[model samples]
Target: MSQFNLTINQKKYDVDVDPQMPLLWVIRDIIGLTGTKYGCGIAQCGACTIHFDGKAMRSCVLPISNVGDAKITTIEGLSDDGSHPTQVAWKEMDVPQCGYCQAGQIMAAVDLINKKPNPSDEDIHRGMTNVCRCGTYNRIKSAIKLAAEGGKS
Candidate 1:
């Protein structure tokens, strides 16, 4: 086991773990942050999406040793009061059915908005590849548009 320092959601945590351990496990099991989910465990599914240095990344396949100094931001860190534009838009648009994939969806949406700011429908369709088995794509698209529009009523 080796000790590593991780800065997650602006909080710093030092942990002793195996180098081969995936960041997903570190975030969920070691650090005790369960907001990031486990889906395919292979990186095919975006269910474990999180921000690494402001870029959306799949945590399940990312080894903790590879994390280095990148700042990690999980869905829990998206907002202190759950008022992030994407979050507000999600609530206003009622984007989740089963809600299993919303966290990853929101995280991916945050990255999309940050990158595109005013993403077109095609841009959204191209950018958000997170799988939602509940098929809430319409609402997710609407929420992304709403968020891009600054979450206006």
Candidate 2:
């Protein structure tokens, strides 16, 4: 077990884990943060998406060694009161059908809007590709629009 110190959700954590262990395990298992899900373990699914140094990344495939001093932000840390515009827009739109993937989806959407606050429908469709099996694409689009209009965030 290698010792590593990583910051998460604005808190510092020290863990003794295999250097090659994927960060998802460290976050969910060691650090006790489960908002970042483990959907496919492969990076294909966005269920484990989190912000690595304020940038969205697939945590399931991220090696602990690669994280270094980078900051980590999970769904819980997205907002102090869960009132981030995207979260509020998602609630206003009722976007989640099964709710299993909403966390990752919201995280990705926030990143998209951070880069482009006023994303067009096509831009949202192109930028946010985190899958939802319930296929609430239209609502997702609407929520993003609502968020862009200063409706939520």
Candidate 3:
């Protein structure tokens, strides 16, 4: 085990873990932040998504050693009261069905908007590849649009 300093959600955490351990375990098990889920241990599924240095990253495949000094942001960090534009838009649009993938979806959505403030429909389709088993793609798109509009919904 090695000691590593992680800045997550604007808070600093010092943890002792194997450098090769996946970030998802470090966040969910060691840090006790469960919002970042475990879907596929690989990067194929977006359920383990988080923002690393303001970029969307799949935590499930990201090793602690690879994290380096980047600041991490999970869904919990997006807003304290769930009032972020994405969160608000999601609620307004009722975008979750099973809700298992919503956190990753939201993280990806926020990143998408950050990259393209006025994202076109193609932009949304290209940027958001997070899988939602509940088939909430329509609602997710609507929420993303609403969020891009500054939560006007």
lDDT of 1 by residue, 1-153 (tens): 999999999999999999999999999999998989999998887999999999999999999999999999999998889888899999999998999888999999999999998889999999999999999999999999999899331
TM-score for each model? 0.97, 0.95, 0.97
lDDT of 2 by residue, 39-127 (tens): 88888779899999888899999999889999999999988887898999999999989889889988898888888888998899899
Off by over 4 Å in 1: 151-153
Root-mean-square deviation of Cα positions for candidate 3 versus the true structure, in angstroms: 1.6
How are the candidates ranked when ordered by TM-score, highest leading? Answer: 3, 1, 2
Ranking by lDDT: 1, 3, 2
All predictions: root-mean-square deviation over Cα? 1.7, 1.3, 1.6
- lDDT of the candidates, in the order given: 0.93, 0.89, 0.92
